[model samples]
Target: MGKIKVTQVRSNIKRPQDQKRTLEALGLNGIGQEVEHEATPSILGMVKKVEHLVSVEEA
Candidate 1:
């Protein structure tokens, strides 16, 4: 599997609870915080949900 970097790019204050939890699951606590994870289907799905709140990069 390949790895990807997920960076929180926006605040979760106005976002849904699921998205906020998704960010936490991705290890993001605030804007600019980043976490590298394997590009598994499940992980990708989570990313997709909060796509607007984050920036993804190849890792």
Candidate 2:
């Protein structure tokens, strides 16, 4: 599978608990933090859940 870079671009403050947890699952703890992961179905779904708070790009 291809790899994708996920970068946290927005704060999680005031966000719903699920969204915050989603970000944490992606290993994002702060704005500008970046993590790369395989483009698996589960990872993609997690990204979708918090898409507004992150930026994704091919890696």
Candidate 3:
């Protein structure tokens, strides 16, 4: 399987609570935080939740 890299590119300020939770759940505590996660439906859903606050790339 391929790895997916999730990076927090934008600030979470003023964002929805759920999106903040998604970022935290993904191990993103602050802006510029990046984490590697397996490409799965659940992770994809989390990514979608905070897509505007983050950037994703294949790793």
Best by lDDT: 2
lDDT of 1 by residue, 1-59 (tens): 99999999889998889989999988899999989999999999999999999999999
Model 1 off-target regions past 4 Å?
A: none
Pairs that collide, model 3 = none
Local accuracy of candidate 2 as per-residue lDDT tens digits, 1-59: 99999999999999999999999999999999999999999999999999999999999
If scored against the real structure, what TM-score would every candidate get? 0.95, 0.99, 0.93
Residue-level lDDT tens digits of model 3 in 1-59: 67899999999999889888889999999888889999999999999988889999999
Candidate 1: lDDT of 32?
Answer: 93
**Candidate ordering by TM-score (highest first):** 2, 1, 3
Whole-model Cα lDDT per candidate? 0.94, 0.98, 0.92
**TM-score-better candidate, 1 vs 2:** 2
In angstroms, give how far residue 34 of model 2 lies from its true place. Answer: 0.4
Instruction: Give the best candidate by TM-score.
Output: 2
